[model samples]
Target: MQIKALALALLGAASMAGAQETASTAMPDDMPPPPMAAMLRPPRPDSARPPEPPRENIAAPSRAVALIAAEAALAQCARDAHEVGVAVSDAGGHLLLGMTMDGARPGRIYSGSRKNAAAVAFAMPTSAVQARLQQGDAAMAARVKPWMVVFPGAVPLMAGDRLVGAIGVSGATAQQDEVCAAAGAAAVKGRL
Candidate 1:
């Protein structure tokens, strides 16, 4: 009888220990498994992080320079007896100033803005882009965006050899517009 009691007590203790071990190791049914990539990656040390890259200092036109350019273009158009719209844009192709003469068409303002965008995008005068397109340069034509105007009405503003911005003119003949835009860009050449 004593031997049998001892055997029964040992069996009960073993079963309880087995049940506790299973309960501790088993996962809950509602819990999701860890991601494979996260589990595969080893822990990183604080000193192992990569250094940040240096930032570039981009150039752009100031508001005062943009206004001066726009006003100069409008004055040039007036002197030539042409009612026109003019737009000035920063190096980032953002419109800084836009103006139209009293007799200018409403759409001319938008045209001027598009022309400015094209000059800024090409980093040259829109006339140059037009010339390249005319020469059967399919690659250059493909680079033109829908909002860009590849007309002869825009010029890139330069400060010494660096492009700072662009000026565009509309509501007149293409040649006249180009003349006005050139005057505007030239106005701020040294100041920019």
Candidate 2:
């Protein structure tokens, strides 16, 4: 009986020693590493780009050519319908030129200018878009209606697959507005 008790005590001590060894040194090899996000963070929301940049060979019309066309278009529009409002924007929707007629009402300039922006943004004629919506196809036009004028006289300025800019002319009949926009686009075609 004394031998059995000693054996049991030795067994218990062996188990205790094994448990301590496991607690002190054993590692779980199957455990997965932490997620990458938890390990490292990305750049801040407002970080500037690098100093050295590679030049891209994006062949587009010159700003001078676009301005010259815009000027001629405005001149032609003034001759035919008098000055109204003309807005011009670059391909990415940046306004490069904005003008209101000598005696135009307030907000007319913005409305007219945005009309051209709408045309370029949608890559379609505003008149056509209006006609589509008028015919109950507002599904597509609705998407761009938020940022563009549905009324006539806005035209997209395209330079091949690239859109160069847009021209919006307003302050007259829809037809007159369209004609004015058309004239401006025609003047810029050389640049496009």
Candidate 3:
């Protein structure tokens, strides 16, 4: 009737531009994954597996097992009549070996080297150094009494991280200076 209504208005404007170009090429069923900067990190720890040994650097327990445990702890403190003093030190404690036994007390060279240097500088075992010299704490009982030997025979020679020194047995009772410093750290347990 008017060019048949202008050909049905150009076929309903070309089917509404082909249904808006097929809904702009679709794709949206909830969508979400894709961003922690695109994900992938996990690999870092091998700068050459080799570097760890210092249990106090160990070792200082030798000096020919400090002269066979200061001659078997001064031959069992001369079988009880007691007169002793023995020493050995190195892992920074100094002295190598020192003796006295034959009726000690040449003024106990200052109480047997300050009680075996306060028992090898307090590595423990001299009855907690007589309960820290009975709690007066004279400056930490004088730090094993001048460089440690705290009686009951000073010890701790170890071998690995290498301390390799310290054994002190002083004249009798500290339980016979720990049985002659445990017979000089058990005659050097096969070189620790």
* Best prediction by lDDT: 1
What tens digits encode model 2's per-residue C-alpha lDDT throughout 7-105?
Answer: 666666666666555553222121333333323435544556455567444333467865665676678777986657777766654566777767766
Q: Candidate 3's residue-wise lDDT over 134-185, tens digit each?
A: 8787876654332333445555555644445556666566777767666666
Lowest lDDT sum, 10 consecutive residues, model 3, at 26-35
Residue pairs whose backbone atoms clash in candidate 2: none
lDDT of 2: 0.67
Q: By the lDDT metric, which is better: model 2 or model 3?
A: 2
Which of the predicted structures, 1 or 3, would earn the higher TM-score when compared with the native?
1
Query: Roughly what TM-score does model 3 have, to 2 decimal places?
Result: 0.28
| Ranked by lDDT, top first | 1, 2, 3
Over 4 Å off, model 1: 1-58
Superposed Cα deviation of residue 5, candidate 1 (Å): 76
C-alpha lDDT of all candidate models, in order: 0.81, 0.67, 0.57
Most TM-score-accurate candidate: 1
- Deviation in Å, model 2, residue 136 alpha carbon: 1.7
Give candidate 2's error at residue 164 in angstroms: 1.5
